[model samples]
Structures are given as structure tokens and as C-alpha cells.
Target chain A: METFSVIFQLLLALSILVVLHELGHFIPARIFKIRVEKFYLFFNPWFSLFKYKKGDTEYGIGWLPLGGFVKIAGMIDESMDTDQMKQPAKPDEFRSKPAWQRLIVMIGGVIVNILLAFFLYAMIAFVWGKDYVKNEDHIHGIEVLTPTLVGDNLFQNGDKIISIEDEPLSELMQANNKMLINQAKNYTIERNGELVNITIQDEGIDYMLKKESIVFIPRVPTQIDSVMPTGIAQELGLKKGDQIQQINGMDVSMFDQFRKELTTMKENNLDSFDLVVNRNGQELAFSSRFDTTYKLGFQNVFFLTHDFKKTHISYSLGQAIPEGIALAQTTLMDYVNQFKLIFTKKEAVKKVGGFGTIARIFPTTWDWKIFWSRTAFLSVVLAFMNILPIPALDGGHVMFLIYEMISGRPPSDKFLEKAQMFGFFILLFVMLYANGNDFYRWFTGQ
Target chain B: MAYYIGVGIAVVIIAFFMAATQKARGYNFWRYFIVSIVVVAGIYMMIENLVLNPK
Candidate 1:
């Protein structure tokens, strides 16, 4: 059921992207009086799920779940129908168009995708505004199971996190875990008012961020607010009002200590552990086997049941447009930076994820706000991916058009065909690799 | 299999570079060799990513 829901959401998102992308071409073609043979929601090479001819255009949904297209008559694309090239070009045909017009037609999908991302982002911003958790605001300090071994010095309890790579603590966590793990950043903290500099240990940090259920800070309350069904704490016979005091014979003083001890246990076979709880003014002992699947399978009822201090700023109509445009630009820049990282940095390589990772981005429990945010983020990604100068994608066609415009001659059909074939293979390999990562994560329970 | 895919990716990337400079005469062998080296590097990285000791 979960898989189906994920697939359904993914398909919906893809379909929205495809429709807008194809419409980008279709609308432009019609405006220029060009003949559009078909408008498809997905590629329909052999067969289509449904199609209908209306006013010289056959509209349809393709069986292939890959992508969609608008077939402009007399255009050279994936459909390498050389027979059309053999015939003399007609006035309304794509081949009959001027260089500049053809350029726009070729780049139609990419432009639409970019616009869609911008629009979605703007709308989301207008509706939901923005939310962020400041690093400094985590005044309780970060709790880690593994003692942070920075260079030679080991950081212990109540060690204030001031910054990463000389950055302010507020700014350090801005880029999510990317700054702490995959990318190295220096840290400067005001520990005991004597300023100390620490280079965040990336190796262990990367593992902690990527590993499932290993939270940078846990959500469990300091006092046991409630017990959940089948939960490790509950199954071990801990009561709703019980206060956790110790784990594994260590006398834990506070909730932070309890969390710190549980988190750093890397061994796979940690089956059972002892927990001493204070219940009804009495200390009681209980032992329970931890679920090997995830490090922990408990949610804090206290935290989950209450709302955080929300800082939602609703912008005026005038403010939203500029904000949206700026947001879109920032997102586009981030995508470019990420792409460049694939070439410049080695750590960035491991961050590459396929559909499984994509699917995991969705919330376990559906929320419209989260859904739109993810969709907007993905829209930006889609725009960037399509704009890459690869043969089979929209960018590839745009590249050819640009070359033709500058060189006073179009690329040879032979070269174009070869490029298309090569592009298809590249895309295939990427899909396989990404999906393979998902499969590995699933089976290994990593 | 991923290693081979990485190799394939490298080959295509090299092919792209080779194609881009096709008009530049007399470097076909060097281009292929350079591209082959790129492919090898890519293979090494893929293996490293896949099989390297997990942190």
C-alpha cells in the first residue's frame, strides 16, 4: 500500500511536469502556425493508452511512463522519420521555419519547466511562507551517541556548537547536512568563552546523517510523557509517566545522556539492553530487544502531539512575485552548484541517488505543504536536468539548433542520430544506477 | 554491473568531447586514449563508491 501510494504520487508529479512541458511546445507551435501532429503526455512509440484526433492534432497518453512530447510536423527528433525529410518541406512544417523560430520551438519544453518551477515556488511561498530551525536555537545542545572526535581533541557534554568552518552556528546548518557531512566546513565555538576552532569530523558525520533513524537531536521528551504501542520502551514495560534514568548499567543523569548512549551503538547485533526507569517514585528495571531494522522505532508523543513555534510570514501580492523569482533563481543556482560538484568533488559522488531516494523524500504521513515543497524542489531539478547539453533531452536539441545558428549550417542527420542513441544509453545507465542504490538500501536495510 | 555502466558513461562523455573537437585535425588517437583514461578513472570511482568500507 505504501509503495502504491508513493508510485501514485510520483506518477502524478511526473504527469504534471510532462503536460506543462509538452504544452510549452504545442502552444508555441500553434502560435507560429506550425503543424503539430500529436501532443502526448508520454512517449507513444508502439502504442498509446488512449488517443484522439482533434483539429489536426492527435492528443494521447503514452504507455511508456518515461516522458511526453509534442510532435511538430517536419521536425527531426527521436522519431527519425527520414521519409519526411525526403519530401519537400511545406510552409506550416517545422523544417520550413526560420532559424530563430526553430530555436524557440526546440527549447520550448525547457523554458516551460523553468517557468513551472518558478511559478510553483512563488505560489508555495505565498501560501506557506518559509520555515527553518536555527542551529543556535537548539539551546539544549546536540546529543550524539558517538563522542565527536575532532582532529585530536574529543568534544564532550555541554560543548557548545558555535559554527562550522568559521561560519556562525545559525549559518552552518543552513545548507542542511550537506555542509556538515559531504562538504567540509570549519567550526568556531565559544566553549567556556575561550573560543575554540574545530573541523567537523566528516567521515562519521556523513554516516550519521545518511543512516536511518540516527537523528542529530532526538525528539524524545526529558520526562516520559507517554508510552506507545509495541515500542521498545513500552515493550520493555516502561510506563507512560516513567522517567528514564539509565541504560546498559550506566547511570544516565538526563534525557540527553540517555539519547547519547543509544545513538552511537554501531554494532548490528545489539539485541537487548537494560533500562532503569523511575516510576511512581521508585526505580524499576526493564530489558527489551531493539529492532534491528532501524536503530529505534519510537516516536515522541509529547513532541509529535504539540506544535512548534511556527514563523509563517504571508507576503503581500507585490512581495510574492519578487520573492518567488528570487527563490527560483537561488534554487537554479543550487542545482548548478550540485551538478558542478559531480565533477569537482569526490564526496558529492556518493550523494547521487535514484528513484528510491526520490520516493523517500515524501512524507510518511501526507501533508499538502510538504507535498508542494518537494514538488517545487523537484521541478527545479527537472528543469536543470533537461537543460543539460545531452542529445536525447531538450537541451541536446537546443545545442544542435545553436550550432546551426552560429555555423550557418545544421548538424548532419548522421551525427544527430548517433548523439540521440548515445544520449538514450546515458539516461538508461543513470536510471539503473540510481534505482540500484534504492534496491541496495532496501535489502541491506541501510 | 555499475562499474561497467560507469565505464559506459565515461566513454560517452569522452565521445562527446571527441565529437566537439572533431574539426580539430590530427588528434583522434590522443582523444581516444584520453577518453579511455577517463573511462578507467570513472570505473575506479564507481568501484570505490560501491565497495569502499562504509563509514
Candidate 2:
């Protein structure tokens, strides 16, 4: 049921985006008096799944789910209608149109994608508002994940991050993104009741990226809410209200730390471990053996039940428009920055993914707010991707059109055909590589 | 195991497409064959990835 919801949402989002994108081209082609031979929701080769002709244009859904296209007559696109190009250019053909008009037709899809992102973002903001966990609300500080950092005195457990490079952090959730995006040189944290400044080294950044390691997580105390009957914890006489103080002689004051210790013990193949728990006002020590799965069979007190101050920014419909646009702009910039990282950082390339990676972004359980937010983000990504100056893409066509306009001589039919073919090959290679990476990650459990 | 199977299927598909192109174009069969191999290899990698490691 969860998988069904995720797949359904993904397909729905793609359909909406693909239709709008093709419409972007279809509308402009009609305005320029260019004959649109076909507008498809997916690639159609031998036969289309469904198709209908309206006047001059044939609209259809293709069996192949690769992508959709607006087939403008006399254009050297993926359609590869060489016979049509061999004849004289017709009045209504795309080749007969002025360079400026052709440019508009080429860029229309990308423009619509961007506009769609902004609109979706606005609607999402208006409906759900923005909620963030303020940095101050992390009363228990953070559980530092990097063992090397602790060893090197860079960061300590239960360190409250105050600022990065003198800029105060507004939200706890955005700290990691902010740190990476800004490439912070210094971090100020409240540790052991004193403010401490830690210098971030270049090596540290590289390590984090290469390892894909999480630096820290918000700390929560490990308080046992309940123990399953006939399970390891209950069999060992562990009861509710017991606060775990340490695991296997390792001090684990927080739930995160306790879980980490458990994993470490499991990894080391330790079948038994010592546990110290604070019960009522007394500390009790016990040695326990793990079951076959190496689980304690106890549930931690629900984290959300704790009272933590959150910052909420609710916007009126009038205010949402500008805020949404701003959000879209920031999202685009962030995506562009991430794209740059792919080329600059070796590890970033491994993160490139296709449909499988995208599907995982949607929540297992259907939620309208999350669905809309993800769709908006995907729209931004689609717009940026289409605008890249790679042949066979909208950006590639624009690049050629711009060149023709500047040079005052369009490339020959033969040259355009070859370039289109080359672009198609390049795009195919990228898609494969990205999806391959997704598969590799899945198989390796990376 | 699944990855190898995927690659094998992809190679067969590429060979089939190359043969079709060879019949239509009537020359440069080897050139088309090689290009098809590269394209097929790329696509096969993606499909293999999805099949072997679906998240």
C-alpha cells in the first residue's frame, strides 16, 4: 500500500510536469505559426498507446515513459524525419520561422517549467505555511557522529551549535546544508557550559563529502517507554521508566548514542553486554545477552512527545506569492550549486540518480503537503536540467539558435542532424550513468 | 548475479538493434554496431542498477 502511494504520486507528478513542459512548446509553436506535427506525453516509436488528431496537431500518450516532446515540423529533433527535411522548407515549418521566433519556441518549455515551480511553491506555502525547529529549541544540544572530531577536539558530544563563521544559525534542521553551502571556516558551539570556537579544516569537508557522513544529530535522552513481553529486555528484567545511562561500559547519555553503541557491539559480534540504568533514584547494573537479531526489544519514549519550541512562519495568500517566488529562487540556486559540486567533487557524482532515486524522495504514506512540496522541487530541477547547454535538450536547441542568430548562417541540415544524434547519445549516456549509480547504491546498501 | 543477467540482456538487445540498423543503412554495420554497444551498455547499466538495487 505504501509503495503504491509513492509510485502513484511519482507518476502523477511526472505526468503533470511533462504535459506542462510540452504545452510550453506547443503554445509558442502555434503562436509562431509553426506546424506542430505531434505533441506527445511520452516517446512514441512504432505506435502510440493513445492518440487523437485535432486539426493539424496529433496529441497522444506514448507507451515509452522516457519523456514527452512537441514535434515541430522541419526541425532536426529526436523524431529524425529526414525525408521531410530533404524537401523544401514549407511556410508553416519550424525552419521557415525567424531566428527570434524559433528561439522563443525552443525556450518555451524551460520557461513554463520555472513558472510552474514558482506557482506550486506559492500554493504550498499558502496552504501549509513554513515550520522550522529553531536552534534554541535544541535544549539537549547535539550528539556528534564523527568519532574523529571528538578525538581531535573539534567537537564534543552534547555540543550546541550556535553559529557558523559568526552567522547565527536560525534552524537546527538546516544546519548541515548551511554549513556545506556556506563552506564555513569556523563553528561556534556551547559545550560544557562555555562557548567554544572550532576551526573547520578543508580535510574535514572532504572527509564529510567522501564518506557521506552525518556530522551530528539532535540529542534525546534514552528513556525506555516499554519492553516487549518475551523479548530480550523483558527476559533480562528491564522495565519501563528505566533510563539507560551506559551500554557495554560506554557512556551513552542520549538515545542516539545508545543506539550507536548497540550497533557497534553488534558489529563487533558481542553476544553479551553490560548495561547501567538509572531507575527511580538508584543506578542499577546488569549484564544481558542479545537475541538472534541482536535487538534489545525495548521502545524508546516517543521523541515528538517532548515539548520543543518550533518556529512557524504562516503567510497570508498575498504574502505567499512573493515568499513562494523567493523560495523557488533559493531552491534553484541551491540546485545549481549542487550541480556545480557534481563536477568539482568526485564523491558528488556518485549521488546522481534517476527515477528510482526520485521515487524514494516521496514519503511512503501519502501526504498532500509533502507531495506538492516535492513536486515543486522536482519542477525546479527539471527546469534547470532542460536549460543546460547539452544537445538534444531544450537548452541545446537554444544554444544552436543563438549561434545561428549571431553567425547569421544556420548550420546545414546534415550538420544539425549529426549534432542532434550526438546530443541524443550524450543524454542517453548520462541517464544510464545516473540510473546505474542508483542501482549500485541500492545493491551495495550505500 | 542480477547485474550480469541485465548486461547479457542489454547486449542481445543492442545486437538486435545493430542488425536492424545494418539492414536499413546497408553499410557501416560495424560503426553502428559499436555505437549501439556503447548506447546499450549505458542503458543496460541503468536498468541493471534499478533491477539489482531498487531502493
Candidate 3:
């Protein structure tokens, strides 16, 4: 069921993006009176799964799911219709069109992709609004789990985060995520009622990403919600409503801290460990044996529970449009900055994910809100990728058209054809490298 | 045996297309058969090195 939902969402999202992207070109080409020979949802090497001809265009779904294409008449695209290039160009053909019209035709897809992203984001906001916790909600301050890399030198327990580089934050967009994504230099924290400035290094940001557990969360108190019937918690006589105060004689205020304590105890091969719990205002000590899973099998009160303070604002349609557009713009800018890290940061290579990783990012169950959110983000990615000035892409075609407009001479048909083929090869190489990384990671259990 | 035949079929298809394109462009005098051989061999080697022999 999980696999089916993932596959279904992936296909639907791709289909929507591909069809709209192709329409971007198709609409312009039609307006310019260019004869579109074919509009395919995917590539058909030997044959198409389904097809129908209407007017001068044949619309079809192809067998290959790699990508979709629109074949324009008199254009030397990946179709390699060199035979038609030998014949005289007709008035309704793409090659016969003016440079300005051709440029519009080339950019149609990218423009549509950008608009689609913004529109989807708006719809998402209007429907789901935004749910978040305020910066003041971290009643026990933020939990820091990375003791090795990001030690107390960077932050102490119970240190209330005030702002990142003078920017106040909530649990939403303008918050911790922005700090990591931007790799901001300094942040302010309220430690002991005194605002102290903490400087962050680049490695600190990278560590936060590599060990995603290190991301700050509201330090929920280690109060037990329920204990398993058959686990060590049962044997240890731990009960519900017990607030665990210490593990291995070390103080542990937060659930995350308690977890780190357990992990370290297991690593040190300590089978027997003790826990101090505040039961009915009595400090009770209990000893327990470590299980293979290194878990005491007890649920703890954490984020999303009634204990953590949360706020949600349901947006009216009128309020959603501008907010959605702002969100979309920020998302694009964030992606662009993060992409730069691929060149600057060495470990960024490991973070690069392909189609498979994308498929897995969706919820295991069919949730329309998350599905639409992911689709919107993907649309932004498609726009950025398609607008790159690489051969065979929309940006590539636009580049040549711009050159033609400025120079008043279009490149030869043979040159265009060769460039298209070269673009296909480059795209193929990139696809292989990305998907191969996915396969490599899966195979090696990384 | 089935896999080899599939590879052979692919080689023939690509070679035929490349050969026909070369001929249609009025390169009939320059031994288009050699182009077919190179295409077939070149594609086969690429598949072997990249797909079959992972390193």
C-alpha cells in the first residue's frame, strides 16, 4: 500500500508538470501558426502506448516514462528529422518563424513552470494555512543532541534562542531552517536571562545537516506517557506520569538528552544502568537491563503532544495569495543558495538525491496537502533546471534565438541538430550520475 | 543468449539509422559501411564499459 501511494503520487506529479510544461510550448507555437507534428507525454522509441491525430498534430502517451516532448515542424530537435530539413520550409513551420516568436516559444515552458509553482503554493496556503510554534514556546529552551561536533561550546542546555543575526523567529520559515540554509555567522540566545552572542562556523552548519538529529527542537521534559507491557520498562517498575530526571547519575532534563544518554550507555556496553524518576513528588531510582534495540520501550511526552505549545493560523483566500507568492519566492531563493553549496561544500555531494529519493520523500499514505506541497517545490526545481543555458534545454533554444535576434543570422540547421544531440548526451550523463548515486546508496545501505 | 541477441538487435538498429542518415546527406562515396561498423562497435563497447563493467 505504501509503495503504491508513492508510485501513484510520483507519476501524477510528473504527468501534471510534463503536460503543463509541454503546453507552455504548444500554446505559443499554435499562436504563431507553427505546425506541431506531435505532442507526447513520454518518448516512443519503437511504438506508443496510445496516440491520436488531430489537425496537424498527433497527441499520444509514449511507452518510455523518462520525459515528454513536443515535436515542432521544421525544427531540428532531438527527433532528428533531417529528411524534412532537405525539403523547402513551409510558412507554418517553426524554422520559418521570426526570432522573437521563436524566443517566446522556447521560454514558454519555463514561464509556465514558474507560474505553476507560485499558483500551487497559493492554493496550498489557502487550504492548509500554516501551523507552527512560537519562539517563546520553547519553555525549556532548545535541545541540542550533537555532543561531539556541536558541544556546549556552541550552546548550553536551557539556552533560549532569541534570534539568528537579529532576525526573530518562530517554528516556521523565518527560523532555524533559515539559519542552517543561509549558514548565518551568529545568533543570540538567552542564557541565564542574559543575551549571549554565539558564533557559528561553516562546519557547524554542515554538522547540523549531516546529523539531522542535531536540529533544535523544543526541549520537552522527559515525562513518561506510557510504558510497554513486556520491555525493560516493565521489569524496571517504571510507570506512567514518571518524570525521568537522571540517567546513569547524569542529569537529563529533555527527552532528546535522555535518548543520547541511552545511546552512549549502549555504546559503552553497559548492560545495567539506572534511572532517577520523580514519581508523585518522590525521587525514585530504578535499574534496568539494556535490550538489543537499546530502548526501554516507553513513550515520552514530546513535540506535537499537548505539552508543547503550538499555534495555527487558518488563512482566508484573500490573505493566502500574497503569502503563497512570498513563500514560493523564498523557496526558489533558498534552493538557489543551497545549490551553490554543491560547489562550495564537499559533503554536499552526499546530499544530492535523484528521482528515487524524490519518490520516497512523499508521505507513505496519500495526503493531498503534502503531495501538493512537494509538487509545487518540484515545479520550482523544473523551472530552474529548464532555464539553464545548456544545449537541448529550453534555455539553450532561447540562447540561440537571442543570438539570432542580436546578430540577425540563425545558426545553420546542421549545427542546431548537432547541438540538440550533444544536449541529449549531456542530459543522459547527468541522469546516470544522479540515479547511479541513488542506486549506490541503496545497494550499500547508506 | 537472449541478452546477446538484444544487444545485437540494438547495434543493428543504431547502425542502420546512422548509416541511412550518412547516405541521405550525400556521403554515399565515403564507405558508409565503415560508419555502420563503427556505430555498432562503439555502442557495444560503451554498453560494456559503462553498464556491464561497474568499477
> Which prediction has the highest DockQ against the true structure?
2
lDDT of 2 by residue, A60-123 (tens): 8876565677778888875456778899999999999999999998888889989998898999
Question: On residues A233-258, what C-alpha lDDT tens digit does candidate 1 reach at each position?
Answer: 65566655676777778756456666
TM-score of candidate 1 to 2 decimals: 0.72
Ranking by TM-score: 3, 2, 1
Fnat values, one per model, are 0.00, 0.08, 0.00
| TM-scores, chain A, per candidate | 0.78, 0.87, 0.90
iRMSD for every model: 14.7, 7.6, 8.6
> Of models 1 and 3, which has the larger lDDT?
3
Chain A TM-score from candidate 2: 0.87
Which stretches in model 3 have alpha-carbon errors above 4 Å? A172-176, A208-214, A247-250, A259-295, A301-307, B1-55
Pairs clashing within candidate 3: none
Question: Top model by lDDT, which number?
Answer: 2
Better of 1 and 2 by DockQ: 2
A215 Cα displacement, candidate 3 (Å): 3.7
lDDT of candidate 3 over A337-365, digit per residue (tens): 77887787767766677888889878899
Which RMSD values do the candidates have, in order?
9.0, 5.5, 5.5
How high is the TM-score of chain B in model 2?
Answer: 0.58
